[model samples]
Target chain A: SQTIHQWPATLVQPVGSPLSLECTVEGTSNPNLYWYRQAAGRGLQLLFYSVGIGQISSEVPQNLSASRPQDRQFILSSKKLLLSDSGFYLCAWSEASAVYEQYFGPGTRLTVT
Target chain B: AQSVSQHNHHVILSEAASLELGCNYSYGGTVNLFWYVQYPGQHLQLLLKYFSGDPLVKGIKGFEAEFIKSKFSFNLRKPSVQWSDTAEYFCALSTLVNFNKFYFGSGTKLNVKP
Candidate 1:
């Protein structure tokens, strides 16, 4: 079975600080990876998605960026974080053949102060 | 642009009661629909999905959804919802070719009482 791992499970970052959230998938190769952020009591907003290594698509323009450094490793990063960046970030993966059904990781809750 | 709409923002029901959550999409093309559930402090899980063939799809936790093309609606239903069923439900749609791009609804929160 495939599993998606994301860390740190919870993060507290000061404003204007750098941000880096990593996601890795085991037991699957060449999977589609996605990053999503959910505001408090709100719907999730798609930030970025990667089809393959070095290929990333931005769904919404914001303070975040994504990279697929390896086939199973995806990272979400920001040079400088904003207060609006505080939310629950989720990393999801799906097989290339079955990209419609995505599997999500435990998620990272970031609190910007 | 493609968009999904979930009618109920929140619903409260007692255990053993029937469950029906409305979902609608505004896209006139070959599309796939899905229902996802997010339990408290848990990641989103696939409740059910409709690609092609059958209009009705059954998913985990004894949940099912029916797709009506004419109505552009996919409504989730459960005969008997338990207390554990209390969670946030989201409706999603994706294009056949670009399956990686999924549009999600605002989600509905369901609370089932004992």
Candidate 2:
């Protein structure tokens, strides 16, 4: 069984604050990682995806960036958060053999004030 | 870029009613289709997927979807939906050209009254 973990489950930050969200997957190796954001009344948007360590692709360039430091660990970071960055952040992992069969982790609700 | 479209934005139905949600995709190449469900305040869960072969694909919890190649449609269906079936359903598309990118629909909110 594969399990994905993400934290902090919720966050409240003032404008210009730095943001860091972590995601880890257990029981799988060499998996593809992805970061997605869901805004209010909008569908999920693909922010970034990583095929392997040190390989990241940005789908929608913005204030946020993603890093795959380890095979099973992925991190989303922002130097300075913007008001528009407030949304639900999700981390997903899929087997390399099947990219679209991705599974999601419990999302982090970010609130920027 | 490929795109997915879900016909129903919101649907309210009583328990035991039949369920059918429309999904259509626009892409030039061969594609993979999926249906994911998200309960309130929860992350998305894969309900089913269609890769190749068998236009009709059965998924978890008595849910099924048919992929119509000519129409580019993959509509999800369930015979008797329970109250627990209340959730938002999303249709996704993944093409071979851009396998890493998955396009999602806006989603259809299903509310089943007990």
Candidate 3:
């Protein structure tokens, strides 16, 4: 079975501070990784998605960026955080071999002050 | 652009009451539909999905959704809902080719009173 892990389950960051949220998938290789942000009482907004290493497609223009360093490791980063960046950040993965079903991680709650 | 619409933002129902959540997508080409449930303080879980074949798709926890191609709708139904079934349900749409990129609706929050 494949499992997705996200860290710093909760985070508090100051404005203009750097942000880094990690997501790693176990038992899967070359998976499609995605980053999404869910504001309170709003639908999820896809921030970025990566198909392979060093290949990232951004869905929306925002303060965040994504990178896939390894086949199973994806990272969401920001050089300077904005107040609007505060939200529940989610990490999800789908199989690369025509696996369209996405499995979500626990998510990271980041509050920018 | 591909998009999804969930009509009801919130719904309240007593236990044993039936449920019908409306979902509509705006994509004329080949597409896939899915419903995901997110319980309070939990991650999103796949309730059901419609790829092809069956127009009526049954999901876990006695939930079912029917896909109406003509209407471009996938409505979720539950004959009898329980308090434990109270959760936020999200309707999603994706292109058949670019499956990884999912477009989600605003979501419907269901509150089933015990």
Candidate 4:
């Protein structure tokens, strides 16, 4: 079975500080990786998605960026964080063949103070 | 703009009560619909999905959703609710034209009282 891992489970970062969240999938290769931010009432907002290594498609313009260094490793980074960047960040993966159904990781709770 | 709408933002119901959460989409073309559940302090899990074939789809935990093409709606239903069913439900839509991007509704929070 495939499993997705994300860390740190919770994060507290200061404003203007750098941010980095990692997501790695085990038992799957060349999977479609996605980054989403979910608010309290608002649903998930897709921030970025990567089809392959070094290929990232951004859904919305924001203070965050994504990179797929390896086939199963995806990273979300920001040079400077903002207060609005605080939210529950989710990392999801779908099989490249059937990309409709997605599996989510435990998620990272980042609070920018 | 193309979007997914979930009418109910919050709902409270007792155990054994029925559930019907509405989900609608405004996009035209070949689209795929999905319902996901997020239990308290847990990651989102796929409840059910509708790609084709049966208009009525059964998902995990005795939950089901029906897709009405004419109305562009995929409403989730449950015959009886349980306190463990207290969670946030989200409706999502994706199309072949968009390639891996999914539009999500505002989500409906269901609080099942014991």
List the candidate 2 regions with Cα displacement exceeding 4 Å: none
User: Tens-digit lDDT track for model 1 on B35-75?
Assistant: 99999988899998999999999999999999999999999
The lDDT of model 4 is 0.94
lDDT of 1 at B70: 99
Best by DockQ: 4
Native contact recovery (fnat) for each candidate is 0.57, 0.62, 0.68, 0.78
Off by over 4 Å in 4: none
Q: For model 2, what is the error of residue B105's alpha carbon versus the real structure, in angstroms, after optimal superposition?
A: 0.7
- Local error of candidate 4 at residue B22 (angstroms): 0.6
Each model's lDDT comes to 0.92, 0.92, 0.93, 0.94
Model 1 CA deviation exceeding 4 Å by range: none
Candidate 1: tens digits of C-alpha lDDT, residues A1-113: 89999999999999999999999999988999999997755677788998899999999889999999999999999999999999999999988877769898999999999
Per-chain TM-score of chain A in candidate 3 equals 0.97
Error of 2 at A84 (Å): 0.6
Whole-model lDDT, model 3: 0.93
- Flag the better candidate by DockQ, 3 or 4: 4
Q: What lDDT would candidate 2 get against the real structure? A: 0.92
Arranged by DockQ, best first: 4, 3, 2, 1
lDDT per residue as tens, model 3, B16-57: 999999999999898888999999988899999989998999
